[model samples]
Target: MSDAMIKVALIGNPNTGKTSLFNHLTGLNQKVGNYPGITVDKKTGICKLSKTQKATILDLPGTYSLNASSADEKITIDTLNDATNEFSPDVAVVVTDVEQLKRNLLVFTQVKDLEIPTLLVINMADRMQSRGISLNIPQLEADLNTKIIVISSKLQTGIDDLKEAIISYTSLSTERCISAGKIENNTITHPELLTSLSAIELKKVQHRETIIRYQFINAALKKSYKIDRSKASDLQAKLDRIFTHKIFGYVIFGVLLLLIFQVIFEWSSVPMEFIDGAFGSLADWTKETLPEGMFTNLLAEGIIAGLGGIVIFIPQIAFLFLFIAILEESGYMSRVVFLMDKIMRRFGLSGKSVVPLISGAACAIPAIMATRNIESWKERLITILVTPFITCSARLPVYAILIALVIPSERVFWIFNWQGITLMALYIIGFAMALLSAYILHKTLKIESKSYFVVEMPKYKVPLFKNVAFTVIEKTKTFVFEAGKIILAISIILWVLASVGVNEKFDNADAIITESVSKNGFNEIQEVSLNNKVIRFKQSLADEASEAGKTITAQEINSAIAEKTPEFRQAVIDDEISALRLENSALGTIGKAIEPAIKPLGYDWKIGIALVSSFAAREVFIGTLATIYSVGSEGDDEEANTIKAKMESEVHASSGKKVFTFASGISLLLFYAFAMQCMSTLAIVKRETNGWKWPMVQLFGMTAIAYVAGLIAYQLLK
Candidate 1:
């Protein structure tokens, strides 16, 4: 066993720097996956202890007790209790904050009772020095019958010592640290009476353990931990007095939210532009280098560009998560939950729902999973159902591209980018919709489940750098993999649909277009006029080919046409050759079928096709439009502005008017803002609800709302 790879589980109460220790031990070598039968993330990494003996470190979901109540807590308990889980640790490391040592020990003691080899980590040792605090490490270690590693995850201090402790894991003991014998005996005898205890009574039991642990903690504090109470800053209390004020708290929160969105929009543009440029160059390189054909088109246009739309938003998502992690690490998020509980309760949501709502800004899948903390079934369900309404990172690509297309980039209020404001407004609208939907759900749902909100607002502490970095990286990775798979599959399917046309409908389109143009007196004009028309038609075909790529080919086009006109082989061949000349060449046939329906929305066939194809995911819409426009243009510039110009300048066949009017652009923006078009979201809702009913309702409801809203915008603006 000593020579074998040891499994170590790092567990602790929330906000206790457990993740910081895990990151310091494992660095970037980590993998995140879902716990079996649940969406709660399970994070594991490999820690190299020696040449032959390695340790597989598991960062278990943070919990206050081994008594499993929430889904997250259940994972922690089950993994430790069941050896068959394979995740069960040979040694358990309990990370306890030096400041909150007493409260943290409750979990530590519970782990010891499991009789696993254990080591106690007293993190934030740097803070003890700053505040003139000291610790008798040997005495504390002796008292706990375990090894103690006092370290600062922030400064990378005591990390070597901690690693050394891990190597000497066999020397650690699993004996009971403190005397809980009498308390356990008393509780067991009066089990029935304890079972009937109130919420406050349950808390008293928690406090009793805290007090018992405090005795030893205080003794250790006198010997080694020291703090000058008079000199310590009261900034946290001062800030809390204002930030957590009954009336002003909500106001401050609102203001803070506005600022966050403003910053996210303003700060993320540079990195986004760089990523956009990099991917565009990569696409061009692939197209030129890969020998022009079907596979080249698929690689360059379908896969690369499609994936770029998602990857470009990584910076923004990382930043958003960075702020969230810092807030949680500093214990500010818990205070926010405490402050919002009353307001959330009135809306039939728990304070815990705030975390999910905030997290949903980055993505909804995890947000739905985050609802496991909500005690009441009704509240949890409502939270899950409405969370998708929060504009997620997947929506960012759509919003960024659309805002660039529709909204003017002039400054407003001498501070905000008009485009940024529009993006922020869309986010706000999503949140508003979520709340309204939750309110309606509260009334409609008849499930009776007792609701409770009890949160411990730990004292503010400086967040550890290691923890913040680990959180950002881990969350970003999850975002990429989860959303990436869906986007890839959808991109392939969409390319096929746009590239291949069925029957004589597409086969004879070129002849029909040519005859119509000739009847309009184009045949009476000079050869230059005829050639110009042919070139324009060819350019349109090239655009479609470029947009659709190799997903559809001339062979598939001929096969589809053959099925329609087996007897008229020569006519079919001529029509097929002509149509293939226009369609296979580029953006020729995209809007032919749906033009009439979309004409009322002020969009031509190209815009119509872009609108429909984008329904799979919002971000893909931008890439789809880019591909369509790029197919028609002569030079290679995949800039959004270039695409917008091509769209605006193109004349409509029905009216001879410019295709992209101000009203049309605005209508498109509004439609995307309101539409529940993301297939990934629909699939997730189905998975979360475990049925088709809710997702179907959501899809239809959102689409209907989008149609009404879009129609109104177009009519009024026009």
Candidate 2:
């Protein structure tokens, strides 16, 4: 390849520590993005070989073969074969762990057959010492006709040797040294089999292909490869006796899930509270420091509040990803898949669907994309359709807030956070719903396709902490940025609608309210005006008391004035004017129109407005409520809290019962949990499915479920 940067690609089977080795070689300089015309990620980084010669290292997605059965494997195969794709690497490094040598060699052999300069990396050499394993490196090198490098990503040893091997990539051979053997010994003896073998050999001879490939493998195995029968551990046999047993496996799996949920809920609380308090204090400080105006209100009450609603959940999300990454990294995830295969297969899903199901706990968008690996169209479609039913991190915020509001904090067993346990229960219910829906879809959908389940069970190793941390940070960053952007935009729009009014809508509220009151001939007018005067007078006195106390006094007076006087009669009418303006805004008009439909759900026109605005995202529900409450307040703590407390206590006019009762909260929570309220998720589904059909199905299906469930919940609880 001239003096231009040599391209090197790392390819291997899944769970082979390919990613870990890439991280060790490239460090934090890697960039991740989707492959061309596909959602499967393409990760690339630069490995500086010397001051003058830097190599571009592309970390291709993990795959088992060149057979191109799935999108991920197709990408690897297509990129490697196409010279114009620019992903064609000059040198290919095939990573294999020492313990899983036979299985690992399958891919290694495939890569060599492609005739690229290849290097075999025997990773986890430290494990070899611990497990009393041995490898005849020189013999393996002769057998494979490729240079070999031994390394341990976890212990950070042999990395320099690996680097040296990469730097000297020109010395590696492109010759294949092995051939796939006949299926049975009888086949080798058959005349037809001999004829087929001769034909294949004749073609290879004509093409000048390496005949030594088969000869070398046979000779090398005779000299080098040996199984240490006495040293082999029985850990797998012992663990499998219990873990994969028909009865115990299912029980252990269920119990493991229960413990994970309990731990996720309990462990995330401390950091969540700290984040909540920090954001609250920041909002309070911003309001106090900034001059009183729309900008100040927007910053303190809209953007910061909305962003906080998302950020506070990061700890919980990070913890969930941490556990998941560890499970995946240590190869325990495949065991779960193996254990669940029979049950999943009965529901028309392959064992591979287990990965997507587990990933759905974090978000449905990636989970839906992950289904790309499933071989059967029917199983993949069912996975995509039902994954959203699993509780995602987005639903966590809604659950946490509502559960805290309605579920008492009393311990379930003197240890569990009862609120936390309830939240966990909601997640379980979501999972159960997902499986049930998948089963239904499986029975109903009639598409025919081949189905197969094949996965490599890599040697178990202690999860590398750096890998876990990197995953947590990357995933949490994506969650915050994607959800944060949408929530922030919607928050600003809601703030604008609530803050300003058109024409004389803002100017005429006071006059309109006063005229209406006077015409009604209500003797309460005098009493109301007297009360307004007392509240304003007290506010003015408080403002003059100290510099630190002026804002509170003004707020209290404004609240009393808004409450006691009709809008028209109120003097110093900024608060009433803002409320009047909001009532005439576009959002306000929409809310009024939808109010009748939602009245049965225990919401007023004001709450109806908030709900409509929050359809952009669930966390926005909290921000919308905060904005609505802030706008209606007289700007005093006592007035603000009084109004909110009154809101919490007040009954719906149509129902003549408390509006925010436990029933209403639970109904809202259920609706938020199941509904496909995220536009981003829909967009991603559209991208992944390459059509509108699947996203449409997901949208309508989820909304229908949410509606029915919400209706039943509210009716029963009410």
Candidate 3:
């Protein structure tokens, strides 16, 4: 009944459906965090084995064997070797693919030799019939000296059987398929012993050991397993030929990309608009209902505004991850990795770089970590340095708002949305820049390294809806909660700075505005606007009076207009007071101080403030604008108070030109595309590289690049 007594670890090779089983077990009751003292992701979840019993399931990183060749493998090796490790499993579930049982068993035997209780789970059992593969579960359990559970994650079958096996895992044999002594110094059981072995020497020993294990596996499988090669279908083969073809493959990928962008824009639009309007109304209601106070103002103008900015883009983020999960689950991502090798070689990268580059579309932190799979250090480093140039979900909020504001929402060729095309173009530009940078770094970095690229071509299948749903939920939740914390803190601080001021100008803003208004009276335009409103009001009143068959004098109309004039005029005066106060507040001073630096990029002081705050997070740029605009404005028409509406209405104080113009919007997009604006990303880079040197260079180099690109874009477009 105790939690400590029921730790179950899922272990397997890549593409073995290990994660699918984990998702089935965990559902939404899961948490993601970093492993202690390392940046590697650790996923843990709890599954109920029975009405009164539950077990903790830890999904370890996928690795081929106990050979610890990569960082991911080393973690597995270290955990299994140390009995005292908290994450070390009481029951190790070795998941294997039915189609590749031989290769998957390589790690199973290694784990079995460690004297740990083990269960062999043969996944994708649903495919066994189609592939003409049959296994005698009882006989295989007897031969391999472990309990076997045949489960199809796709069909959601055999899950209860697997759970029953886990509850009885203590009875399973820990007998090794081959003697541990076959491995030199028994390093498979005692990983610390591997510290003395050279990389080449260690690999040779692992190779010899693997050959021995396979011999034992072949003899056992000969008795319990049967297959008919002719029964297998060639549908996958046919599809792979086209998908991996050199010429047409790239074309298909391009078309798929355009389609994805179009869907992201078109499908998410209705939900996004609804969310924007909801948040705007919530902010308005908070101000109107809550008793007036500084806290009330902060709640409405800061936290809610900041949150609304990022939350409105959830639909787009979810759709993006939905497509990515589908691609990965359908096994097409592997083909992509294989397909990119030809071009990768020419650019001084390995085919393995493609995974990180594509994964960077979701986030750079994970993409950088994915570089560990690359054998060569030089290629890995180049991939890490350039992966940030690939546009991530963090930049999606900035891009979406700016594009909607500046780019027309018209269709191209009566099908493609202009905004969608622009978005796709930006994505392509990011990828092209990443590849170009990789090529340049390839020529510049002189580190000597050589490694051959090898990629697995997985059998394509229909993506599981459960897997796709979990991925979208997990990824979107992480984006909101993680980015929300930083935005919240910055928003509160920005609210304080924008509300209070250090100088007399901010303090005397109300008096200054009142004195000026009183002295000059209404300006020509203000007088005309007031006169037109009075005229409209008079006409409406006269019409209503006439409809009632009552005579209304011209004097009564003048009296009514005079009665409403002061109320309307005061509203105008209050708006000017709010604006003047914000312009002289602490936030405004900071913005002005940095204005000259960003002015060349077609940015004003307000945008300078957003840019500076967004260094904490790139997505915070929109949130920053939201908070600033919320703080600067008073009395909003509920229908037109969304963040986009506010941004669209923004104009330069000096030139009176629109702030989010076509030139400035393009300039900003180019800046975000090239800028390494995320402090967390910089920190991660520092941790990954084991020093600040590379991240520092990354920071300055990217900023310089972004500035130059923005400057050029603005100058040419304007």
Candidate 4:
């Protein structure tokens, strides 16, 4: 049989369990992407109806009604209004909550008026019995002129019934509930006096249309629907009183956030270490097993090491999204939004800004896009402008590495890990800075618009494991692929920049190393024969230690060998040689040119190069360091070498002191915490605001803040 496909659109009002049904139908088969020429997310999933037919279920954005108010709502209008649209559905599934059927039915009635073959899915059927609500399924179906399928999206009951109805779509009705004549020319002729209609006028029309639809719902539900007042819970009210309490709510939110950060640090460590070791081993094996050549070095040092830097952070990134997903699924996030509104309002932001700000922890691009729901132009802009200041996962790698270097592993107060505390503090700092900046921008930016904030307080439910798992998997994959591509490209370019030379100085590095080694009273063994020379030299160090009546531990002997033996010392010479070569390379010259600019921040030319490369992505700062350090790490045991160890052992070229000192680490941490280093975020800001002006100000303004903050941190600490 030839495969036939049907496009089935899933539409519903917000908080109606539309997404839960979508997740159930699609499972792991769903695809998430943006609609063409717009930033609004598009979710589509394929479900096998039979051997001969398939359904491409598109989950359109959730909206309250047909009257479009925001960018997300517009996507629904566009998809349903245009018959020629490739995504047009053969049958539209209107999902509604059984408990809130009155409000949910408003959307169904509006969609039915579009003359589309429609199925009404009354979700949460499990609650109907508990809530003592009963539907006259036959009477409602006959009156509404559509088949009604009652299902519990949570319990996965009655789904097969819905699927069977979907397969029999041709038998369903395309009869508009309200006549087309009633809404001709986007104007509704009603008892309430109104002239020609605009969007605002249509919203008023939509409001009256709600009342009209409820009249029909009321008649249909008269004998069909009944609610038991006794079945309701005071638990919801009791919990809301405490969770939304003025003093206690803030404390609970703070503690929960802190615990989340602590869990991220503690839980992610074992997996992160494993990933780091695996990638390091792979790169080591590549260098050792593959034949010596430019391509081999590029694969091992540039590609593998760069990839290592990214995948190693997957653990932390996954944990961050996991906690966030849990909060969202459990309905606690709504309370958080409500709790934050009063505080957010003082900063000229709507209460809805909490969603984007909280989501910004994952990535700024989506977070900024999430701001479209804010009805106020000024508030939305302010939210977008400051959302990046929230600590995103992109900064996790940089923060993780620097925090580990500067912060000790000891426990604080005999319970909290010092490193974990610092990480939590960094997260808090990001949030505080975001709010503070919003406050400042609120006072400065003059643009204002009428504001409205409305968020549904979803009833608390144990989060579904399937939904939470899917969310973590999808988000982690997105972070890896999206950030990995950039890191891979930059790593290759950086490799070439550090590999190639500007003059004969790099070409004669071998001779220069030999001359320097011999003049320093060390035996002159060429790079090739240095291994044999080092073996013999180690025995001499052992004899010298014995003659001096000094006990040399195995590690001490190895250190002695590393310092004196020609093979080990030759690696040192090579490292210095590579450093010089890099100093003269294209990337090195750029770093050198900017060295003076970053000098006060406790950064040298090498750090300057990393900073310049990192502007493409903040996460790549670690990858950049990995690529640069890999060049000089030749002959070191792959098992013992880590980026942190390499940095700890690095000697400053001018000061001969350790790089990444306490002062420098603090400065670097501060810089990454505040820098607007993501090009994608800047582009998104441009697209979102529909202009370059806002993004430019964001870029420079953020960069200046980062610079000043870095300067102050370094100066005070150094």
Best by lDDT: 3
Candidate 2: tens digits of C-alpha lDDT, residues 110-189: 67766778888888877764454677888778767889888888898887787677778888887655443421322211
Candidate 4 clashes between residue pairs 3 or more apart in a chain or in different chains: none
Per-residue lDDT value at 352 in model 4: 81
Per-residue lDDT of candidate 3, residues 1-718 (tens digit): 3434488999999999999999999899899998888899999999988776789999999999887777888889878878899898889999999888878988998889988899999999998877667899889998889989999999999999999888887788777777756656666876765788887777777766776676677667777777653464567755776887789888988888899999999999999999999999999899889999998999999999999989999999999999999999999988888888898888899787999999999999999988876767899889999999999999999999999999999888877988999999999888888888899999999999875653446778999999899999999999999999999999999999999887898889889989988999866545543454466567768778989999998888778778888866875577667777888999988998999999998999989999999999999999999999888465424544799877876667555567899999999999999999998888888888999999998889889989999999999999
Specify the poorest-scoring 10-residue window by lDDT in model 4: 186-195
Candidate 4's error at 317, in angstroms?
A: 0.8
Candidate 2's C-alpha runs over 4 A off are 1-233, 270-274, 502-506, 510-581, 603-615, 632-658
Worst 10 residues of 1 by lDDT: 521-530
lDDT of 1 by residue, 424-510 (tens): 778878877777888888999898976654344467899999999999999889878766776687556555554565555555666
Q: Which ten residues in a row have the lowest lDDT in candidate 2?
A: 182-191
lDDT of 3 at 295: 89
Q: lDDT tens string, model 4, 361-401?
A: 88999999998666578888999999999999899889988
Predictions in order: lDDT = 0.70, 0.70, 0.86, 0.82
Total backbone clashes of candidate 3, pairs 3 or more residues apart or in separate chains: 0
Question: In what order do the candidates fall by lDDT, top score first?
Answer: 3, 4, 2, 1
Q: What's the TM-score of each model vs. the native?
A: 0.58, 0.62, 0.69, 0.69
